[model samples]
Target: MSQMTSQTHAIAPEDADRAVIYGFVGRLLQAPPSAGDMDVLRALTADETEMGLALKSLSEAAQSANVNSLKDEYNALFIGLGRGELVPYGSFYLTGFLNEKPLAELRADMGVLGIARADTVKEPEDHIAALLQCMEGLITGAFGEPATLPIQEKFFTCHIASWAPHFFKDLTAQNTSAFYAAVGALGGVLVALETEAFGMAG
Candidate 1:
């Protein structure tokens, strides 16, 4: 079982909010993003429950992508010059620069949530994977406690809901994207689903 799934608690329906947070984290960690999981991606667009399931499905599917393809995607999305068609860094999204205040803000939030950046990770804390990991920690009690709905809503609004979907949309449409295109589609759909679900819950 995945780390998040292994750590999940059976909270009451009133605390079901954690499931959404965990699901998003699981997906981001499973793959940087990919284009071959369209069926699961489409399902995620329908509802939060479906989104969670699709995320799990994609995470599992990502493991099966050929090694060559994975390397290609990594090269296309992160190593390409002249901005690589999509910037997946939070600093870029927030300040039009890499490793800027947005990254600093995310680091502050990580401290608040009891998340620490892995020493092995060379990327900035605002990288999408790091953000998702922190979200998982917040929802799964890896932090002080599972975050309340109000806190979850605030986090989503302040961080994720602000720009991740746009990044995903660009990933989907980027000419160099293939495996990541599906990831972008999934990210776009999931963000909309999460925003709508939270809005309705309010």
Candidate 2:
């Protein structure tokens, strides 16, 4: 899988870092991590911040993670018999149902931003993974020119800040979570950081 980066976009280093974190978390949530993905995770290093601590934990988890076990864990956590332990979708979290007004609003914003879902993707665009990927694209010019910080802040406030923190919290608390617990912790910290950063930008 190709890594997402904003180096070609002339964005700030901080924006590039934001894109990488969004892409990393989004990729892990989008599906089970392959062995290659695990390798990338294992190579990650951290510092002293909360996000760094979470990254350190995730890197440790990746070092010991088995691909097949992760596959099973992914299935159990995201794609069980009918539903998983948690539904990782913005609309569901916001409206207590799937495919609601929030999704329509997102679609409208996506249209205005010239963003379109892949034809191969059957899931709604409100899925958390899709939203994070959209943010990464917005930051890295994957969709077009890199969006301004204000625009990024607007999209994040409308779609991500409203519900993802709660979802990540639930994910961390999930009974079936093991490796994903690390994912949840990292996601939570990332969301908090994003929320604070956007607030400062605003």
Candidate 3:
């Protein structure tokens, strides 16, 4: 009997773009933007498209913001005394509670994808930032193989497709969100782009 073996494919240029976008969004959401992060953001520009406009807006916001102000906003919007204005977790968004079944299912899938939770991270596996990071890893073969389209689509449909765009739309409207409001707008575009690409691939 032949043994089942794994295959690794090099990521195409277009898929590489998805990985970069996912990674950027993941980092932007995972924590407050640092001065270095803001420095890079300050140089960006957007075009006529929604994503471009969002990016351009982000650059404008970043120009007005420093590390301290961005930190304060991050704390206010995502890390208040107990919790923030928004909970960026899939479980919470999908089921209105934390530590729920959605989180459990995501953990199971993450293990199968060889995506172990980082030791320093305390949040559940279904956090939006973590999920995006996972998607980036899958695309770049950080977990193992460059994940096949079916795998990517399966992960996206089960985890992201349901809740993230809703969260982004909400984020963009939050008064406490300035830099992150722009981040949210960009995230909305990203969710759309990934969904469309995945649909075509599938």
Candidate 4:
């Protein structure tokens, strides 16, 4: 990751573009291996932007790991017997239930933005992947409109800010985490960055 400086400047919403990139990087940080993992990893590692480059470095470092290992790590973190050691679901984090207040709230917000949970997902819409996908959707204009800074902040604060940092902290300290430790580091840093950046906006 490029060293972020403490230079002072105008607080225009455009100044938040870096945070958007960081948010995308945070998504990539926690992404498990997919069919195109190599290609995606290469793209991110070779990316010119700071977040992309950071992701790329982590990706490269994690290259020796096979997809099955990544899957096992993911399962250990998120899908243990009946429940994982660290539940990555917003509803569970917020309401202490699998699909409760937090999920309802996120569903309402997603509906307003025209995002629906995938039919294939058995989990609630508050899964970390789902929320990260929402962020991606906002960035890519998937909800028929681009998300304004305030919109992004609201979504992030309401959903991600509530618990993701703690989750990543757990991931970082997990006994089974190895390559994912890098992911946890990236996530922890981004959460701190986002928390401070959003505070600046407020």
lDDT of each: 0.62, 0.88, 0.84, 0.67
- Deviation (Å) of 103 in candidate 3: 0.5
- What's the CA error at residue 11 for candidate 1, in Å? 2.6
Residue 8's lDDT within candidate 2 is: 59
Query: Which of 1 and 4 is the better model by lDDT?
Result: 4
- For lDDT, the strongest prediction is 2
On residues 141-201, what C-alpha lDDT tens digit does candidate 3 reach at each position?
Answer: 8777788889998998899988998999999999896778889988999899888877887
Instruction: Compose the digit string of candidate 2's lDDT tens values, residues 103-178.
Output: 9999999898988888778889988899999999999888778998888899999999999999999888887756
lDDT of 4: 0.67
Candidate 2's TM-score: 0.94
Query: Which wins on TM-score, candidate 3 or candidate 4?
Result: 3
Native-vs-model 1 lDDT?
A: 0.62
TM-score of 1: 0.72
lDDT of 4 by residue, 1-202 (tens): 1112234443346445544555454454445666476555545534554445456656775666677777887777777777777888887777777878888888888787767765655667777766766675565455555677688889989999898888778877887866676676666666677678778988
Better of 3 and 4 by lDDT: 3
- Candidate 1 per-residue lDDT, tens place, 1-202, comes to 1123235555566446545544554454345544544344444433446655545545554555554676666666766665554667777987899988777776776666556766666767776665656565666665556777677777777778788877777776776645566556666766687688789989
**Model 3, global lDDT:** 0.84
RMSD (CA, Å), candidate 3 to true, equals: 5.0
Rank order by TM-score, top first? Answer: 2, 3, 4, 1
Who wins the TM-score comparison? 2
Candidate 2 Cα misplacement greater than 4 A, ranges: 1-8
